[model samples]
Target: MEGGRWDMLEWLGPDASISVFNYLDNPADLARVGAVSKSWRKFVISNQFGKRLCMTLCPEISNFTHIQLWKRYSHQNASPSTSMDWQILERAHIAYTYFAHCFLSCDSDKDCIMTCIGASSTDRFPVESIHNTLVPTDMDHMVYWRSSYWSSAGQADPNVQESLIYHLKRGLYLVNEIRIRPFKAFFQVGDPIYSAKHVRFRMGHSKF
Candidate 1:
């Protein structure tokens, strides 16, 4: 070894060592490699080995997933230090990749890839069932999304506009499209999803 230190991996050169690390599938192992030595850390981050492994693990994440969402959040939270840390950046990248996979990969046609985990609304079916089942999940009843749901109250006198604010528990999502399904009356002979004659939609990124 160069500085009288017994570098166990001294036999393998930088390029070769990276090749070996590239084979690591476990994200924890990659993170631990950084703590092993500064050289190993640099090697792992320089090639973004973690991000590569994440891509292999989640094939559904396309290049159009808008990586800028992650970058924007990362930069907002980043320290003022001059040198950028690719290792940290790669970790965030991998996290967002997995999060995107959770929402984008669907088995059924009605399964919306919307990452909306929770919702708040000006009106709901019943005041008690607000947060229970506003969005579709795999566990929803076979045909119907769920018996539990939300809906706007009376829209008469003033004809107020109804609004439902969906939330993402993970982080800022790079959403291209959002699917909305009107509720169905299960007791009816042919249970059908009722549609609103006209609907309005809006998207935004909020700091609060």
Candidate 2:
């Protein structure tokens, strides 16, 4: 049985030991290697093997565990360049924002809500007229809103009034609510009529 195990391990290829050690050095590699085979996937996730895999593949993983993995790697490896670090941080921010948006927009959840509005104006009267015509006559602006399950369940407070005020001050028309979720809602705001198209509104996000 030991000889059989040895032969099987041998059959895993000449680089099998290196591959295993690589995973031990940086477990993040499992993200890619996991797709290779069911046996490999099992090996990657197995507690006895997983720690080594993480150590082996830690250099490459970029999902939610990126920061922690990078921090550990940095202790043993040269610190990454500032530009690379910034890029990673930016990507993490985007991921967080995306997750937040998804959470707040998921259906049947009402814990948070968001609203937005946008508008534009042109110098040429004729061009402005044409643009207005393309938009709904009744809607010189657009608005979107979403409510999360938690908010609806009374577990959290709503900020509909503050959101409305913010948009109105910027001369944006509130079109409608786009989505609602447990964490957020999105709304659309339009620019004020006769405002120059070049005069972009200073848009921002605020928790209400």
Candidate 3:
């Protein structure tokens, strides 16, 4: 409050505060404001402000879920930049929904699901290998989806399904060999509206 206009910042709503803070060209300035108080900490953790800042600074991020979620949470008046393509928006929405579901599952422990949402290359990681090779046979965990690649026919291809199942099975087997619990894995190929150049992949772990 000494050297900064703290009173003005305190007057703004969460979204507006973030917008103003981000408008400052210096990252150090943003950090200073963020260190103000517990309320500010909450805003930072919730991504209420950082996400908006990102969207405002980089229009491309408007097509990401974190920004959209921040907008929805804050009820901010900001709109997606005019430059954002509708097709990209649609795909990002779908991907966000899938990720939201996965987050909910993780939070509730209802499904014991952990999702990996992103391009195909992004989701291709060895979980069992990372987890010391522990694999559960009965419980399945791991859903894969391709949001960028969709069939011209509008339905998912049998080949994609087969490939998902095969890799998932292999992954499970690797886990099993290490005595790890198996969690159900699901792979989705998201609709074309959400992805163009890259295929999105999602993974879910089920409790039952």
Candidate 4:
């Protein structure tokens, strides 16, 4: 009503309003926009604008068909009048808001690995230590990272699993993709490649 303070949503049609909101890639900006009015808040949450922005910025998670609230008992505290559908949308809104912010807040241009915590199993103490994985590239043809790659202890059963933990450069990071190149034992006779059939990643805080 006053100078420069008018509800744009009131003047613009739905399509135009959506087109305008589409340009906002920043999570903070989106949050501020939603706070402008109750209608704007509903529009942002109901349409999953945060999720759309996150997928647009991080293509790796674009395949996500659904998202659930991480805190299981959070729903128990909700008011009785809050419908399940609205609760779901609200969960998505909160989750995606933080998710997008995690991605945007970090400096994606640099390496995020700060240090290796430990591996579930290492073939050798120093030679095949999980620390070797930190090396970006091979140093010399003969000797590199003391052995050039990390190796897990031979497992009796193929079903056995191994894992490596690392401290990230920042406490919060959105790891959308991981690239792993299996180690090739060039010095060996057959030059066999050692790799896992599949790999998985997890993130969390370290216990003191």
Backbone clashes in each candidate structure, one number apiece? 0, 65, 32, 0
Who wins the TM-score comparison?
4
Q: Which scores greater on lDDT, model 1 or model 4?
A: 4
Candidate 4 lDDT over 36-108, as tens digits, reads 8778898998888998898887777677687655565254657889888988888878777877887776544
Candidate 1 TM-score versus the reference = 0.55
Cα RMSD to the true fold for all candidates: 7.4, 16.9, 16.6, 5.4
TM for candidate 3 is: 0.27
- The Cα local distance difference test for each model comes to 0.55, 0.33, 0.36, 0.76
Q: Give candidate 3's whole-model lDDT.
A: 0.36
Write the residue-wise lDDT of candidate 1 on 81-182 in tens digits: 635555355555556444535444553233333443333443544432434344343333222434455545545644455455555444544444655556
Model 1 stretches with alpha carbons more than 4 Å out: 6-10, 62-81, 84-147, 153-162, 170-181, 187-192, 196-208
43: Cα error in model 3, Å: 6.6
TM-score of every prediction relative to native: 0.55, 0.19, 0.27, 0.61
Give the C-alpha lDDT of model 1. Answer: 0.55
TM-score order, best first, reads: 4, 1, 3, 2
**Lowest-sum lDDT 10-residue window in model 3:** 170-179
Query: In candidate 4, residue 190 scores what lDDT?
Result: 87
Worst 10 residues of 4 by lDDT: 137-146
lDDT for model 2 comes to 0.33
